[model samples]
Target chain A: GQQVMQIPQYQHVQEGEDFTTYCNSSTTLSNIQWYKQRPGGHPVFLIQLVKSGEVKKQKRLTFQFGEAKKNSSLHITATQTTDVGTYFCAGGLQAGTALIFGKGTTLSVSS
Target chain B: DTAVSQTPKYLVTQMGNDKSIKCEQNLGHDTMYWYKQDSKKFLKIMFSYNNKELIINETVPNRFSPKSPDKAHLNLHINSLELGDSAVYFCASSHRQSYQETQYFGPGTRLLVL
Candidate 1:
């Protein structure tokens, strides 16, 4: 069985501050996907990293995959009120296998 | 059009009652999954169906059953639900051609068992 753990289960930041969440897996993953769930909403696909040491950026959000493929990170630069949500990191073990999700990091931004 | 859609956005039932939630994905993905999000927003995979065949079955309770009548639809039926079953159930779908593919999720069904 694969297990994913996320750090800083909860985070409270002032508007315009930065935030980051780290995810680690007990087993090496083939790929890792990040999702964001707004309050009272479903989890929306954010990004997916397949290659080792891959880094991708979307607007103010940056995603990085560790070289070992066992860890990942999501960093948000200059967070805003709209950034309030729970960010989850899900690890893919193999082809056709289901994703094992981390507990997720809930972000609260105060303006 | 919604890529993935679920029925009964909210469900409230008494303990020991049985209820079903329906999910459909027009994305034409081959793999569908059921995930439970607890009060803390921790998402856990409950089951997965690939091409209408059961593929991933997590350590879910026997009272919960999932069925995929077709590639585009997956339904979850919970029997004799308990108070602990109060959580949000999400249905998601992925291509499954590769493990790295993105998954599309429905709005989610909030179930409250009293």
Candidate 2:
């Protein structure tokens, strides 16, 4: 069985500060996807990484995939109230298989 | 139009009762999935369907059964629901065309068994 684990299960940061969440998988993944769930809302897809040592940026957010394809990270710069939500990293074991999601890192930002 | 839609957004019923949640996707995707999110928000896959065919069943309880009327509709029926069955269930759809499968999720149905 494949498993994905995330660090800092809970994070509380003030506005203008930075935040980062790390994800590791028990087995090598073919691809990884990131999702965000706002309070009382469904999970929304954000980005996906396939190549090893790949880095993608979306405005104030940055995503990185490990060289081994077993780990990933999400970093947010100058967090805002809109950034409060749970970030999940899902690892794809093989083609056409269900993704294994991590416990997720819940981000809380206070002004 | 909503890409993925679900019926009965909120359900409150007593234990031992039977209930069903319905899901439909308009994206014309080949694959649809059912996932459960517990109080801790840990998402786990329960079942998957491809082109109206059951493709994956992830050790879910026998009381829970999923049916696909067509490629666009997938429904879940729960019998003899227990207190532990209370959770938010989400239905998602994805195209099986490429390696990076981007899943489109619908607003989850919250079920509470008393």
Candidate 2 per-residue C-alpha lDDT over B4-111 given as tens digits, one digit per residue, 9 for 90 to 100: 999989999999999999999999999999999999999998999989888889999999999999999999999999999999999999987333799999999999
Off by over 4 Å in 2: B97-99
Q: Where does candidate 1 stray beyond 4 Å?
A: none
**What fraction of native interface contacts does model 1 preserve?**
0.88
Clashes found in each candidate (C-alpha, N, C closer than 3 A): 0, 0
User: lDDT tens digits, residues A45-86, model 2?
Assistant: 999999999999999999999999999999999999999999
What is the C-alpha lDDT profile of model 1 across B1-105, one tens digit per residue? 999999999999999999999999999899999999999888988998889999889999999999999999999999999999999999999887456778899
Pairs with steric clashes in candidate 1 = none
TM-score each candidate: 0.97, 0.98
lDDT of each: 0.93, 0.94
